[model samples]
Target: MSSRWLRPEVYPLFAATGVAVGICGFSLIRNITGNPEVRVTKENRAAGVLDNHAEGEKYKENFLRKYVRNKHPEIMPGINKFFTDPKY
Candidate 1:
């Protein structure tokens, strides 16, 4: 609402400050709640476990995917190829 902020000369500064504040806010939030950073040292390089639940469990298709497959099988033929397997 201020006349100074409405001037073209202050537009760049206002935009820059807004962007800087946004970046700082996002950085602070990420630092507080983001996942822990992983350091890939020699000891942990190959020690990481590869989780595979695919073999132990049957893949469950979501209702939307199932509906599309059943009702509109002809729709999006290219994409439907990936879902050709009923188990997918």
Candidate 2:
């Protein structure tokens, strides 16, 4: 028999069904692997500390420094080096 998808009416329905299934599959995968526990822990009051806040800021700064150094190594010779030092 000829292919069912060759019909004009059937193509739209098939495309819509495929899109719906893809969305459902993506949601299921995200729920399984997206680390919901980290979100819950962050929301918990006991886990929030001033040191954690400071460390987060420092981590962001270090990441930016490394990224900038990678993009312009000659200009930022001591960028990543200071973050690696034990003083901080």
Candidate 3:
């Protein structure tokens, strides 16, 4: 039964079929995800990236510190100690 799969004539058909299926799967994935091109103009795109950082910096602390303080206040003492204490 195993040898049947390896027969000379049969192998090419299976190999060709597998190659076709793999190519189709690759194209299907690419099509479903998105086109590869970044069509937006360069100056506007660069401006957007810088703008996002500027917006985030408007806060007193970076977003992560603010998140931990609000949601995980119990950890704040340990966090402050880690930053301020001289001992490693």
Candidate 4:
């Protein structure tokens, strides 16, 4: 209202310029960038997932077994709350 150059009506022009600059900059960068390569290929996917899962489960069981042997000394591994119903 008071300043001529800093009028509220010029705010939209500044916003539009900012958005245009952002889009132009993004487009320029993307145009120069290469497509990402997959470090793990399809051949490794299934086996890697299965192996990791089995290893993780083995670690969990071993850790829990050790803890039970030291602390509880009575409770079995399969009898815990973590075990689901066989039907599922």
Write candidate 1's Cα lDDT for 1-88 as tens digits. Answer: 7886688898899999999999999777755443233324657446666444562232234345666675754758766877786755
lDDT per prediction?
0.61, 0.61, 0.63, 0.59
1-88 per-residue lDDT for model 2 (tens digits): 4766477778889999999999999767755554233334535546643345554555446545766764754556587667776775
Two-way TM-score contest, 2 vs 3, winner: 2
Please give the clash total of every predicted structure, in order.
0, 0, 0, 0
- Candidate 2: the clashing residue pairs are none
Q: Give the poorly placed runs of model 3, Cα more than 4 Å off.
A: 35-88
* TM-scores of the models, in the order given: 0.35, 0.37, 0.35, 0.35
Give lDDT tens digits, candidate 4, residues 1-88: 4597898899999999999999999766644442122124556444543435554555456544866666744356456534755643
Q: List per-candidate RMSD values in Å.
A: 13.0, 14.4, 14.7, 18.6
lDDT of 4 at 41: 57
Structure candidate 3, residue pairs in collision: none
Which prediction has the highest lDDT against the true structure? Answer: 3
Q: Any idea what lDDT model 1 has? A: 0.61
Runs with alpha carbons beyond 4 Å of true place in candidate 1: 35-88
- Per residue, candidate 3 scores C-alpha lDDT tens digits across 1-88 of 9897787889789999999999999877754443323225566556543435443444436456776775645547788878889994
Best candidate (score: TM-score)? 2
Q: Give the distance in Å from residue 68's predicted Cα in candidate 1 to where it truly belongs.
A: 36
